[model samples]
Target: MASSPLNEGLISFLATHAPNDAFAETDPVKASQTLFPSTTYTDAERAEISQWVITSSHVGSPSEDAAKSAERLSSLNTHLSSRTTVLGAKPSVADIALYQKLAPVVSNWSPEERTGEQGYHHIVRHVDFVQNSPLFGLKLADKVNIDVDNVIFKIKPIDAKAEKERKKKEKEAAAAASAAASGTATPTTLTGEPAPEGKKGKKEKAKGAAQAAGEAVASIATGKPTAAPEDAQTKKKEKKEKQPKPQKPAPVEKPLSPALIDLRVGHILKAERHPNADSLFVSTIACGDPAGTDNTSEYEGQVVRTVCSGLNGLVPLEEMQNRKIVAVCNLKPVTMRGIKSAAMVLAASPRVVEGEDSHKGPVELVNPPTDAKAGDRVYFEGWEGEPEAVLNPKKKIWESIQPGFTTTDSLEVGFDVEAVPQLSGEGADKKTGVGKLKTAAGLCTVTTLKGATVR
Candidate 1:
């Protein structure tokens, strides 16, 4: 039902080599007559030719048929050369027809002469006869016109001057129509106007009169003038008079004494598990920009820097290499399990049920949120900073400095506590009190205090 590759190749070969007479039944009897014409050869020669054609048709099978086909093919080649012109001589229709039929067979010949000088010479002679001979040329020309409908040769030159004049006339007509619709004139029109000032002034006056008359008629019909009513005018004046005096500009808001650290997207270049910590990995991250160094003094030749994080607790070390991730590069360094962890990797976790295989289990996936990346400055909506202060602040406070005054007993309260005093004399009056002050935690807890609430 389907054509095999060999068949398709054969068909393509035949179509190209014998394009003029591609169809098997191109002239039926005429084709058959050309290859085995009755008048040209004797009955014995015709019978031999018929046997040769039969043999060539069955050449694919390696039997007596193939041997016969080979012999017949050779006979056909000799017969063609003997009957028709060869080398550089004139060619006949029979020569063209025979050439097309034999070209496919000749293509399969040994490389020594398959497509060598002899074949080349035969083709050149045929092409020359088709091109130059009047009868063959007429047939080819007619076929070309029927198929392509265009001349191949550039026999005549185009009239450039006439073409330019035609295009110029069309452009001028378009310009005139455009100018008339726009109420403008071509440059040449201004020179043609007699009494230019008088004509222009009259036109302007006529336009103004027409607009005024239209407004007047509208006002009369609607019983309301197009201009503001007297009441509206009075109201506007009264409102302007009642307007408040402009207040002085508020004092310039100072920039907060804090830094806003940026979280940027970066690609991982290298990754290694922490020597002692199985849950953490040390990864070298490259943020792509050479100017985005966190520590300018320490990192000189490095386009990428190493940061130890708890990624091994999540993703495997092998999977982390060459992966893109979002990281908080400006966080203050802290030693985790004897390894220095410089930044945090942001990830999202999905809930997983128990008994699920670990490979198929739900795990947190790390991704850059909202097109964010490493070395990109993340900010609190209304906060200003050097990014690092926001990322790693030393302290955070929300104390109300102004205290309330009460009419009760005098209580000497320490900064640590605000409760009523239960003692008197030296115990209550002691200003030098020693209290344990807790150290401020890192940026995470401070950020949690300032607007980053867990839901």
Candidate 2:
């Protein structure tokens, strides 16, 4: 059977995208055992570059190790001489791998370093060539597109040394715990070894027997059982009385007000990767006709909004497809990576762990109830507002409002309304002694996911 043309096409595609291994053999014989040696070798090279170069260095702060990483890369690029791309005369998987790794660090470099004053002229040229390459299908001339300088490349490795140390500590802890359980040493004893049972035990036994004999004699003399020594009885009584009694705590109450901003239930109609940004998704959301839709204006009755979300690495595409979600409807539309985003999706995720993937955990969408239709107003019990046509980013309205947007005890996403004195002097009859807010009204949330954080 003959190989299809797809074999060469695939080779070229992988060469440009996937790249070679991070630690492949530079030797031609060992490298050529596989078809696409460039891809294998380059992939290995990227892994080494990411681990040694990016992971070891702190972002925004260039350390000694970072300088060393840069120097190593410079030397390797210098070896490439006047070559146009990585591996050979044309671009290969190796070029893509190296380009992606170097671009982030180099883009953040000072002007002098970028211009080859740092002796990385070859690296600078390669980065520029790859950035301008047409293979990624990005229209990068647009200012809103992703800027490589802002990217932080993180690679997490389960360190063997750290793991070994953890195990050693665990073993030591277990041994200490076992010794404690067996009462290997008593608190009162001065010696390192366990106190001898013969000396202490014999002395206590002899003293107790003498006391008992003395008591018996006294009882016979008195013609009745003698009472315990007053001091000893008092001490025992006091000891029993000194124990603490557990107390239940009083309940705490929170004040409430109406929701501050406009939130709506939205359904994701379509989701696709942004052409110009690696970590962004261009999505179309169906929110139904908003409150003020009329025949005269485009903003009026607009049921669908285009949103640009940074859920690329955080959420799986399959999870996002046709899912019901919560959205901030009034945020001012902005151009992101050349795409106009009209709304913002709401999601919840755990705090990021350093050196680990930020998207490693589950990213749950803030979903609305099935009964809540699209475009239905999401507001607090006591607050009310017609949705703003456009919120100002410069004023930071969203930032101010964001902190208060959270899930209630009922698991519904709503505003954390403030408590104010009732104007009618009906505070005495109110449940909260002032104004109280309901747990769920028009908010977007799911009953089953109660107490989940909505970010």
Candidate 3:
């Protein structure tokens, strides 16, 4: 097929944009300096150049006359809209090539002002169409998209089954060829020697005669002949005594449990310093649904729950804000400083050299690398399950009676609310019935009389 005018125009545009430097001679560094001249081109100038390249390439041969070229460019713009799907599907190489050629033109179509109305509209429509199409139709790999200047270019996936079948056939063919070659190879005798050939002169004749005499004598004497060569006997013995083939070890089975997987990636929703403790801060972290949708009801499909710990003593308050960290999220709660603490943040302790001053012990708060984001799950070595919670010893709660009473208490009960009369005789006073317990005739009774005045 003949090369499209668009292709030719693109090539020309690239050549101009990436011009060779005459002053640099062969040095790329010096050539770049001379070619670029300035640090950057103004947006307006760049857009104008891009538009010219796009129109000229797509519109075909530019006439010597300015008016003719302009007319051709307008006609080409109209033709592209009517013919090409533009950005309806994924951006093709053609689209990218055209975009690169006309970068300046597209850039010039700023949100603030629109120039080259027809051309600009065509580019916008093309981009919109591409973005809205099925990602697979564009042949894009899973979770991967090509982005250029905030524009996404998608490609559909290749046929996996077809690819697998092609690979399987290739492998089978290779195996057959290998087997055929192996089958044609010569087989070794029991004695590890080549089979005897037909008689070839005196030495073979003498050997055959001796073997026949020996076999005849053995058959006549014992009805069993030992015609086999001495070496053959030795070879047979050696083969019999050969060690048995070794068997492959069975694969070790692993338990399939969440405790076996790691679920550390999540976002920090809220953080608060402990009121009574200077070295502790309570943080509420949300490990969003791993399946990508909030479907679980326990935590609104949140994979991880809140964890409270003493981070202020180890990490700076400012650094903790909006930061993602891998933490153990499934830990039993413990109490610290009369407050229930939940979950523990995973931070690497700094290595300290021997003989370091105990008072000035160097401790460093481990931070996740920049590539890691909030809600990114991490795994620990040898651990089988996902991290369900952070380790916080202070978040533990003990079983109690009376809402907060221990089993040792004689009166095992729950919270009892009672209303007391107000001084104004308008509202009732709220109080616990435990304080108003009365013991009479070996019986205990707790009662509350609403609106009753005790003066």
Best by lDDT: 2
lDDT of 2 by residue, 1-455 (tens): 11112223323433443324312433222323232322233555444433322322232234447777656665665544434444333233345445545656776666555543344555565666565533222233322122334323322323558667666645544543444444442311211222334445644544443454455444544546544422222222334446667887874322222343467667676798999998888877766543223211111112367888888877787777777777777777788988888788888654444787656546667767655545545555555545455555675556654544455565565544222332222445543311212223334554444444455
Task: Give stretches of model 2 more than 4 Å off.
Answer: 1-260, 290-303, 351-361, 408-410, 417-443, 446-453
**Scored by Cα lDDT, where does model 1 land?**
0.38
TM-score of 3: 0.25
- lDDT for model 2 comes to 0.50
The parts of candidate 3 lying over 4 Å away from their true place are: 1-263, 289-304, 351-361, 369-373, 380-455
Question: Tens digit of lDDT per residue, candidate 3, span 126-212?
Answer: 433333332112322232122233433322323558667666645543443343334421112212344455435655444544454
Point to the candidate with the largest TM-score. Answer: 2
| TM-scores of the candidates in the order shown | 0.26, 0.34, 0.25
lDDT of 3 at 322: 62
